[model samples]
Target: MKKYVMAGAISSILSYQACVLAQENQSKSDFSKQSYFLDGFSRNNLDQEKVALSTHASRLVVQLATDYQQGMAIDWADYLFSEKLDGIRAIWTGDRLITRQGTPISAPSWFTDDLPDYAVEGELWAGRNRFEHVMSVVMDDKPDDMEWGSIRYMLFDLPNQPHDFVTRFDALVRFVDQTAAEHIQYVAHFPALSESHVQSLLTKVDQNGGEGLMLRKMTGGYDLGRSDNVLKLKLAIDAEALVIGHVEGKGKHEGRMGSIVVKTDDGKVFKIGTGFTDKQRGTPPEIGSLVTYRYNGYTKNGIPKFARYVRIDKSKQ
Candidate 1:
């Protein structure tokens, strides 16, 4: 049951042109109908608010990853890297799928009917640069069959397992195959051959519009909350902040949000104004929720320079 990560070397496997084509193929269409997957019987006639709050969340028991630090001491042989999928986190609790906040996500019967009884955690992804679309379809109280069909469940772990990462990943592979679910696949991992290998993978994913890479210790057992065993690597510095207030727009944005004031984990407060679209600006993250933002570095005053809004955390609210 215990083995290692990827057997092959992390080379130029992901084609750049194909990545461009894939990005080009990503939909900018209205959250209109498209794609496949999921089951939708119990939620056949439920309102979005009712379905979204299917469960009350007190804590996020799922294991979380820390931001990767450059030049960190890591024994290459003991760690593995997987593409940090830019999709919402989903926990399949035997019979249904829920967000990290324990909010229910209605899927069609076909989507969950064949999944194993044990809990599995993964990203509900559509593809690169399609985070918004994935959010639209997944957050809906009602299941969008066509859209769900094309969306995928890229599993990274089997929670509550008694084994290390390797065995857990091995178990995940078997579960994926045994179910024969087309929309379900394991997030492939490869050894951290060296810093170069990590950079290569990071570059490829970035070029293809991906966020970054996730590094996990091969020998570590899954632990809830942030752990050094898991880390995130990205080009720009990314972090989550607690929303404290909203700044209204003055001109064209006069009617909607101009920016949001957020407090970082360390208590640094700032406003994220750039990187939001018109649609998103109109509906900013609510107060008391969490939001992920990107920044370059800190200024002399200890503020994140050029902070940009990324995505709002839906788990808290």
Candidate 2:
């Protein structure tokens, strides 16, 4: 039996040290700030070892296109699938559990006191319908006792195994089956090898008020950045970026007119002024939307380029 060091039980009241630590890492602005600054193709290779166990934004899963059923994609035909989670995305570096964004998750000692020495990626879920509640519960360093009991830390990926994702996932399933912990369970990964299959799943998820599916490759190493091996198949056109600056208006767009400059994690910036109606422009997106701007990919940077505004993403708010 592998025994990992578990942090002492968390109290309902957070300690002064925890408060100070949270404040230090807290961002000044969630709107204009680059919240999801990591979901993209890396210009340079990121050092995975440099990433801390607690940072949620450090790791990325490879996205395998549904079209790619052969070659490396089939390496895990028996490995992946879709499952609804009413929790937050998390990763375990064997010893500690951290949110996808790198924040330390104050998981209850009882939840992960006996987890194996492997890095697993999944969600700290509460229920299929308690999505936001679970999200809120997991984000707090001082987790609520009542909420904690309602949540389950589901494990999906095993990082310590040197085998490909297929092999690693096999080990993960076995570990989950062998342990058979009460709340802990493994998420089944399904294969959507066609556009219709992917779209059908998306529709089903959306209709059921569920998020989209995660497409992962079977043959790739866990490299950072937006790799084709790991793609998020969602119905919405969402992207998070930094508000570099605001674009000036032209013609009737003078003064209170114009678009806003936004940059993705890969340093791709563009002016997005279209998509907005008069009411939207009047109040603008508060200089930042952290939004999902829709466009035709009219430019070289894979952005809408001279794109228009879309609705502000309140979920990210």
Candidate 3:
């Protein structure tokens, strides 16, 4: 009888421990699923590290645009073209501004005091061709008050709204008008242009140091991630690649870094030697870091032509 009692006690203890372990594992699994679902991402598609790092604290995710090809057939009349501002993409969550990557912006209180309680998606712009300046101002943990004064929250879209593009644009315009805030302004969307007219506009914008153009389908709804309804038209094709190795410099650049060997997401390997400043060559993008590069187009053998290093994607880290 004594032996049977002891055995029963041991079995109960083991069962309790097993139950606790199962509960812990289920809790972890639930947390992971919640994180991915909130961020509008799929756990199956992303790696473990990315899934762990994903955050949707802002409760908002902006829609992304696809690249536009020259002479691509589309209904021009159904789209609204706007100047692609060379600045950081920021999402205004009514109370505060957050980067597209979910990092919070530390703008001065006065900057957001006039914004509405609803969310607005736009870019933190510092005029045309002032990307670096805008980045310098907003990237700081504590933004500089005077520097932020020059920055503008260029309103573009209203995410999560049920209205079509035209209705949303009008609503955004009215909201900004009512606020009467200097730092907040609507991004002017131009009417559709002919193919020749688009080329002319691109030339003019390029000459003025603009980045490119964004075409928003007037009939489409705002959707998360890259959408076919929206397109980015740029002269040079730009893409992000992982830096795998570096080559030694020669001649004038001897003793310093030369070029970086990179592999695209599609497994295309290439080396970018140009577009690096002296400082960049000294401290090149570390191996395993993602870097953006610009190229004219792809060669017949699937190689990027005139590949030039653009910038390191610091957000990936």
Candidate 4:
């Protein structure tokens, strides 16, 4: 039997460290549960590595996107737009795949065996608008073969490649073909036709139940932190906040949770009363769970206007 060596985890919790060292082994010395923790194409390649396991997975840094302005004065032609996937951010560090927070995902051997021996950044997507389902499958400590079989590693970027975005993506395509892994795919990128074209594309995606479009500057290298070079445009912007408190519902919603009081990273606090299903209202996100929410622009008081609950990250669940 092949064994995955999980070492050097920095988590303060002893159980978490034990889980990491155990490599999801629960019974029969096999991976059982995994805790987990994409793109579009066109201008060049939908195109997109593997290496030894690194205890340093927690240190992985990824380039993040900034909100796109409606009429920003940048050359649209320089950008490659693709769908903004609502999948978990995962980095394949040669030998092992780890989540954004550096925890090993309990994936089956056949699922990851054919992956390259270098670094590739992408999403573990189940399908369109299935974020909640994806979370349930990917976060469980025990690995579910059937559910994992339905997931795909949708590649979008080559983090360590010295080349620019276009070249890196082209290389990623070749890399994916080399592995011939059925679950691995490349996201296609499209060139900008015009402002109206961009808006039309955005609307088309939104209408189809997709979240939004990501604009990547073809000439830009993969740089970490928020940058204008990579922008996100969605119908209603989504962000993450920590659950602080819950308010009791009144009127028709009386007795259950009326709303969840959440605090953003910037220290702003607000209540989200909408977007919860009956089941969700009965079991509102627990205090301290980081939750994702959608909202329009902020109000005069600097609050996220019309803020509504989305799903919480699997780790928090």
User: Backbone collision count in every prediction?
Assistant: 14, 24, 0, 22
Off by over 4 Å in 4: 1-57
Q: What pairs collide in candidate 3?
A: none
What TM-score, computed on C-alpha atoms, does each candidate reach? Answer: 0.78, 0.55, 0.78, 0.80
Give the number of the best model, judged by lDDT: 1
* For model 4, the run of ten residues with the poorest summed lDDT: 28-37
| lDDT of each residue in 205-287, candidate 3, tens digit only | 66766777788887889877789778998888778999999999999999888999999999999899999999999999999
| Candidate 4 residue-wise lDDT, 140-258, digit = tens | 77989999987788788877565667767666765665565677776655566566777776776777677888888877887766678789989898989999999999998998999
The models' CA-based lDDT, in order, is 0.72, 0.54, 0.70, 0.72
The candidate 1 region of ten consecutive residues with least summed lDDT is: 29-38
Q: Write the per-residue lDDT of candidate 1 for residues 151-227, one digit (tens) a residue.
A: 88888887766566766666666566556567777676655767776777678778768888888887888877788
Residue 32's lDDT within candidate 3 is: 23
Give the per-residue lDDT digits (tens) of candidate 2, residues 129-165. 5665776676677867777877766666654344455
